[model samples]
Target chain A: MTTTAVDILGADDVSRAITRISHEIVERNPALDSVVIVGMQTGGTWIAKRLCESVNKIVEGANVPLGAIDISLYRDDYSLRPVVLSAPTDIPVDLTGRTVVLVDDVLFTGRTVRAALEALNDYGRPRAVQLAVMVDRGHRELPIRPDYVGKNIPTHFSDEVAVGPNGVTVSAVAT
Target chain B: MKHLLDTHDLSIDDIVNILDVADRMAEVNRRQVPKVPALKGKTIATVFFEDSTRTRLSFETAARRLSADVLTFLASSSSVNKGESLRDTIETLSAMGVQAFVVRHKSSGVPLQLSQWTDASVINAGDGWHQHPTQGLLDAYTITREFGTPTSLAGRTVAIVGDIKHSRVARSNIDLFTRLGARVVLVAPPSLLPSHVETWPVDVRSTMDDVIDNVDVVYLLRMQLERMQSASIPNLAEYTRLYALTPERAAVLQDHALLMHPGPMNRGVEITVDPADVAGSRILQQVTNGVSIRMAVLFTLLGGDSVSSLTAGGEA
Candidate 1:
């Protein structure tokens, strides 16, 4: 199946979105002294790092901890293929007392986000975790929902979203 | 993703997908920017209950290339030696924010148990003689790269020589080769070969010479002296005489046939062939392909792109 690329957010637009999301997070969670951003590998990770940078720029002296998470091994498909172990997670800052902003590129079936949540639990329990995504395209099979959404795009189940250096586009097929 | 507990966890499609990704990862090495920011800011913890230099180093290198942070926990230095439980150690690492865990244990199925205990992704580095899935993958990648796309090993005979009953590498390779259609022949002394070899899919031959000339590939397995209680055979000398891949015996193979070994070689005992022959043996290729194959796995699992995008990227 082939997916048609539908433009939802561009590089410039993503930057703006992050800036706005940062402000929203700080405003909503007033009690937190600092925030740590954890990306859910690949696109989520990139977005999380960018969001951390943006938040830092807005709030001076803000301790924006950044981390990347790889959930490959926790995947349900482990038995079905060759097992490749990637690098471990590195969260320089402690999650014990900090508000965690979990960042991802796209929110579709919510399986990845669910996996990310499970992965995060292993690290330690954070004071709170808020989900943020560049695109919330619906079709969630789980009860999970993103707290901060950059853009909401209606899509068919057959369609898939692609986020790259260029921009965000929806393809009818996953490609 | 549940941790890959054993080869039984993988289907044919999973194997093919990993190989395909490994093929792409091989190309990454040739790029100006070998580092992919894909895993930037992620953490991967390597919890090795066994002493492994190659496997540990390879996993560390793979994670760094993808820009992920890594923590290496050696069993010797850790509480594991002080009677610290595996579950306790893993749970502690999990609490430390380790997203992925690369584990190696002396006991088989330790990774399986760890998978159930924590939320972190678990990759089995080695678990007793149960399985070494990544080793099998890299071997397959090496063979495919050397001999062209492994269409089917139907006519191809693979002679696996060495400690058959003790080497997890042998067990994993046997499974992978057989699934890809290769007829596997286990070459070992009666002492080394398990008594129930007949139950396995491959043929078991006590005489190395019987299958030496007929096989298309001779995969030499390392003799894990550490694992053996008393010598399974009389001694290393007798074992070498009967099972070692000596230079003289290697000459009997067809000119087109290849030799393979998963390293940490036993020198004169398991292989009478010179270590330099490993250049021609495709052992080093297996090592190099290891990084590429692992990268493929890391990216495929963490890329976050849809299946269609991955296909498009593959085509591109």
Candidate 2:
């Protein structure tokens, strides 16, 4: 069963969005000495590393600590499916009192952000946590909202977004 | 993440999911380019404050297979000799961009504490005697692979014989086996049985011979001399005579019944039956499964998905 793919954001658009987000982050928190970019696993993680690179280029002497977090074990549905052996969560920097920018590809239900928060809490409490997403498809089930949104894409509950190193595409199927 | 905190964080389905992923990882182990670019630019810091070679090496192999660099920190050469706390070492490593932290500490909740202090993933290797989630998962996988179904443990009686009080393996096995539908019998001397055994969902037996003929599997646990602070038993020999799985006693079991052990076996102390001739011995299988199981765990926790799925009402 094949489905049609709709171009939501291209690679150039993503790079521009990330560049703008980096500026916004520095503007929002002028005292930010070092930024720790934690990707929300899978695609979000790749985006986070790229965003960190962009942010480093913009700010002098500002090197962002990067890490990838997996929240599979913390999922509420953990009991529903078989146990999934997850990859190693790699956060190569200390999170103690540092400004944490959680990056993701798409923010749909806000649950991923919530899980990232829970997973981050286990690591350490950050000075402040800012959420950065390439696409913020609004359908929040919780009170949580992103601190810096790249592009707010509105859609029905059934639609989904697939983001990779190539670009961001939207689909009707639930991914 | 470095530390494997607790088995309580894992559900029955979580255990099964990891086992399934491990099956796939096993295939990866056979390939020529066994290494994947999954954790290419990453590093896994394994800090074992306790004594363990099998679990440590298994974790190392799993990380290496994923192409993640490994930095092993044993207590011997570490600043731990200078009384540097685990927290200090973790913070130092965190500064160096150590991505994931696999920690095995003697304290029950040390991994959880470290998890709270670092940004890295905390994979509890084995904490105190509280839980060995990976060991439990691998054992479950071994059983499933042998039986041809994940839930084949159902209706089977698994008798866990030996140091139940001090064995993290036994504790994890009880949870996993029971979840897989096996009726678990924890056979050990009263002194070796934890006071909290009554709280667990398992039948307790003081004698191994009583349950020998009925069980489908005999699981022996090691008896650490460190645990016997004041000689809980009359002597090691007497203890072996009373509770060990002797060759003659093993012969009483059904021919199809298996024998298993989470090794670093204590030979004559825990089991009088030689490990070499134990017909159903899957101890080696458990070790082999450890790498694959760990690979599945690392990939699932870090690889293909978002952290969102872990939360309530997370994005699909």
Candidate 3:
């Protein structure tokens, strides 16, 4: 039997999920003056940009500043992991007194988020830090959960939840 | 993937990979904490058989920033003075569980020899006048930082002026610059030029004025006064007249051209004070880049984050 990938969220579904997330974020951060958003590098940065646009559209001219971070070096299992390729990590402003919302593409093991939190500590101590993810596939090894999630996909151990600009896909591992 | 003994071992892809990592490591320097745990639990040993100010300090600083344990061994004051051979000294350190060795020696090929004697990865800081791979890399990083990309140097001119025969920096830069597709012009007195320069892959010339106006970067090499008198170049005063980077020659450079020097500079001899301090000069920047490039090298060689462990074959 041939193995194939299946789309979990189509373009319209992805758009609706983002719109819902934007509304939730605006409602939680009403003043919109203290809240700042940052995207984890690679896939998360794209989603963060879209999320920023969606958030701005709701609170006209909020123009929330978005930053991107690559957490390659901050992971707890650094010696065990493979050589991590790095990207730009830019935080335009100090995170000290700001309410920070971290955006990521997928949340499975919760390890990446753990590393992101630790990495953020090097930058500054935030007033409050919240996590927003596009896809949450349940396999968390840590006591961590997303504060705001786009879609939750519960899948098998070997399955992959891939999120991109096109949408989201769930593919079984090729045996 | 084992040891970095020379630039000749590095392909264009390898060089780019290292520089990209260096770019990432540069961010750590700007961070409030200015450190990373990427190389934690690994041990690095620096063996300096020759005297150095920037190199030994830079390597140690890079290792500490990565959170790796650093052990520095100075051969002059260490076991090498008491009847121990180079092999014995390295083997003793290897027994202590060192994962990497950064060696600087007055004799050529010492790093290469150490690689054969130990399983640990060897980084050639400088081995006599043979090669200094990382200096070449930092210079490349400096260029890429200035021009926006290493490949942008394809048609750019880089003229290295001063004593050539005794400079490991010149040899490394020549090998690296030509590999990255830059036209390199070697300007030195006929007495100071290496005898075997005929086979080298750069334009061998005797005067700086002929090539000064056209080059994008002018890198001045430190004159080896120790090698003068015995070699063709007899003294510093005569050598200064033909090749010193003075205010007059620095003025002749194009507006966008950069000035560089591999330091421990013999000021007023090879380069005038003001010329070395010019706004276009990237001398100080190169020193900063040195620490980052070294961190990149250490991380790539020892930062055990395997691609297989995190990517395609990573088991959940």
Higher-scoring candidate on lDDT, 1 or 2: 2
- lDDT (C-alpha, whole model) for all candidates: 0.76, 0.78, 0.86
Candidate 3 C-alpha lDDT tens digits along A53-163: 889888977978889888888776755667766578999888888888999988888888888888887888888889999888888889988999988888776777788
Give me the overall lDDT of model 1: 0.76
DockQ of each: 0.02, 0.04, 0.52
Docking quality band of candidate 1, CAPRI definitions:
incorrect
Off by over 4 Å in 2: A1-175, B1-4, B305-316
Can you write out model 1's per-residue Cα lDDT over A37-153, one digit (the tens) per residue? Answer: 888766787788878877777777776678877655345433333444454455666577677889888888777677677666655677788999988888787899889999988
RMSD of each: 13.7, 16.0, 2.0
List, residue by residue over B1-316, the lDDT tens digit for candidate 1: 3456676678888887778767656644644445545566678898998889999998888888777899999988988778988889999999999878888998998988998999877888889878888888888777766767744455677889888888888888888889887888998887777768899998888877788777778898888776456667777887788888888788787776778888888888788888565334777777888888777666555544233332212000
- Compose the digit string of candidate 3's lDDT tens values, residues B194-213: 89788898897788778878
- Candidate 2 lDDT: 0.78
Q: Candidate 1 or 3, higher lDDT? A: 3
* Most accurate candidate by TM-score: 3
